[model samples]
Target: MRKPLQHIWALPVLAAGLAVPATAPAQSIDVTLVNGHPSIFLWVKHLTETFIPAVNTALEGTDYAINWSEAYGGSLAAVGGELEAVEVGLAEVAAIPTVFMPTQLPLQNVSYNTPFGPSDPRLVMESVAMLHDTVPGVEESWHEYDAEYLGGGFALDNYVLMTNFPVTSIEDLEGRRIAAPGPAVNWLEGTGAVGVSGNLTTYYNDIQTGVFDGVIVFPTAAAPARLHEVAPYVTITDFGAQYAGTLVANRTWFADQPEAVQNALRDAAAAYTEAYLVEQTDRVAAAMATIASDDDHLHVLAPEERTRWASALPDIAGVWAENANGMGLPGSEVLTAYIDALKAAGADLGRDWSQR
Candidate 1:
């Protein structure tokens, strides 16, 4: 739980008569926060509830303060356009989805390319932050677009399959169309299933209308969307938690801010990421429990089958790295470092993607 805010009046009553003429009005800094997703989404929700409030709290009783203007739900930027919005100064800060901007943020999608890594969102986020701090090209990727890379990001929970049919094994998916977002379409490459691109907004309808037999989605979203009512057969695919996006500040705006204001924004963003992970973990457990109650409708893929499915896929990670290398990015280095970090953290990886 987040700490409650402290009242401004609680500050000490004027340094024991060491007063100047009068209390100077606190500095008002106007900031615009952006995200393409609606506020109902955890990442954007936290930006409003946690991040913005945290920034306010940090500056309470101080000379610096924030006046936040929020734009979400594609008001200022649509999905996959957040980077552009922030780059062009349409917004001062934004939560940009790395998966959506593959060409611009190639190194940021290392986790998506190397699937079946770890289900722990915290581990993945921290690993990525470490890379941002230590790796050469990680931060540079953001600077190229006039945005500064914040240390943490929104990490999605483990992906599950909600389908119209039961998937006891990977072979059961032959001729089926499974909807996945962004690079996740690659996850279905060798499973004999056709992977169509889709997202949460259209998932329930698409499956219900037979547009796709199933959707590869996380439980946190599945439960609230009541996806089971439409696609009742739930398969815990455990494709692994993914680092979806990060909150970025416009580089010029951030550089021009006072050090104190900059620190407050950075701290608040970090807090937002931490709070989001805790909320997501609990929501995931509850969602899985709710869907699991209907035993007849739920199936946890067999371990051997999970491994078989993983081993069957083409070297998507290697290809991603090769593509990155072609762009003169340290593709192989980031891949090797990420896989090594996951191994050190004892991730039960179904496939070691960095070997290539």
Candidate 2:
């Protein structure tokens, strides 16, 4: 088993008011951690490196500490199984990518279709926080599923393409298999490209074994997976950097935690949010450098080709909203509010799906 990533030799003491109540003697608080993706994804790395260390630091003086067992590589929960895992108490804490469960977590799917908007991690995070705060009873969706969202957000660099062959125009992608998760596939519909179902773990082998021609994933993911070796063509789409993953714990497990442990978890969430963004932002530049000089064919998709993509995709917004509505989540309102917020933040409404 590989050790998780961590930074910081020491952490600052918390303010008096922020401290959790230390109650009872000889009580130990344990949290079982589950990650959906393999340990290779940047998001998982963030959980291990930045998030867990911060949680450990915050819980140093407390009787509560994470047992910190990783159920990675699908040993515990398979891909797209995280939400159910947490709900059933298979894991006390889990990082569930909402895009993976669009049918189950409709409320969380707001960010996936609200794309071509913000690529900045900071902006995405703030927007998500605002949605949780402003949207009516958005937090209750978790409870309905028997889970309590502790805290979760993704800080991803801009998304790009890693292909086995060079693609400078939209025509190059015609009929080519591009591995993408849920709503991401909707972006390719009507474009003559076939979207395959695959995650980061399956990507490397898929590319190497010719299972896919390329993958529509973030640069942060491409680098660590070493996809550059097999798929040499790197296209910078900058279409959007998705921010959708969130942490949820079994409500029963969370309620059983001592106040000190709860506080430690909260502090860890804050630290993870800050550090995750910083590392992800930095990875963009680092990945570019590595790709450019390292025998990878990097191509910046031209403006016209991007326009073709923006034009060819179906009206995913309305479809998504309707899907959520079917699931009894606040689909329509969440969609409208999220779009309005993005527009207020100065996002250009490139493709008018409202009319469609």
Candidate 3:
């Protein structure tokens, strides 16, 4: 009886409350992440494990979310095709292996051009990250390709030579067709080894079919690829780990995003770098152990021979820097800053690339 008295006015308020939508769920932004290589690669693996997860975590409780569509391993683009893919907006983001796109992203290959400086993955990563932050040319190079450089600066473990036969001296590499990825072919100059341009995906089949005599590759990758099965003789060349690639987003797509989304992408990239380094460190030791257990497969080149091999090489770094500078890029500054960073980190450099 009490409720029935003068309760007709309250019905409208109750109806209004019912009509209001329960705060609509956050709007989801769809982002496609493309990488030419399969997720088996450490860098690609962490895209799911660390980077994407970190971004999702950072955006939690926010009014924005990302629906990630991952296209990797030749699904969206073939190896070396990521640059063009992102440039044309085929994908929103990409893990671009700059080594593969040397012509377009020359500055990102500074570490590749300046090898034998440091074998520590962490140091290489930090130096490259620093270069990206401090060097305008580095960032500008990416912009030229219509992409914004995200923060994933990756370094592989130290490179080694996996050959069908043993390599005890520089003479052993004479006339040998050794496979090297992209610009790393430069590392073979004057070593008497013929460096064929090849990548991890094709090396195993190439070596097996006699396309090349051996491959200049790192342990973590070689182990999983099972290159040891075909190229059983492993020589620890100490060519040093290298910063090979980074995350990039389509410039237009990135510009259209909210500031929070932009920050989340960058923060996630940093997390990717750290996660990759940790995995690479642990995996390198484990891979070495796995190889060491098979004594017949693993051999460390004598330190003297390593130095001799390094000395036999031409001034590849100098030539590389000079060539880049000729093209109006700050190649020397990048080289100097990189070597300086390595030296500051107490790296036992095999050659003074900056001095040349």
Where model 1 places Cα greater than 4 Å from the true spot, the runs are 1-20
Candidate 2 lDDT by residue in tens digits, 1-356? 64443323222234443577656764555567787678777677778897789878887766666667778768888878887888888888887778787777777767667555566767767777677778876778888778887775674666777788888777888989999877777777787789887778788899888889988887777777788888878887766767668777788888888887777776777777777788778778887777555544777766676767777777788888887778777788887777667667875444554445
Question: Model 3, stretches more than 4 Å misplaced?
Answer: 1-21
lDDT of candidate 1 over 7-54, digit per residue (tens): 334344454345555688998988888888777778888988899898
- Number of the top-ranking candidate, with lDDT as the measure: 1
Candidate 3, residues 38-128, lDDT tens digits: the string is 8888888998899899999989888899999999999999999999999999999999998887777777888787767678988888888
Q: Which is superior by TM-score, 1 or 3?
A: 3
- True lDDT of residue 343, candidate 3: 89
TM-score of every candidate: 0.92, 0.86, 0.94
**What's the C-alpha lDDT at position 48 in model 1?**
82
User: Against the hidden true structure, what lDDT does model 2 obtain?
Assistant: 0.75
Instruction: Write down the TM-score for model 1.
Output: 0.92
lDDT of 2 at 170: 74
Scanning candidate 2 in windows of ten residues, the lowest lDDT window is 4-13
Output the better candidate (1/3) by lDDT.
1
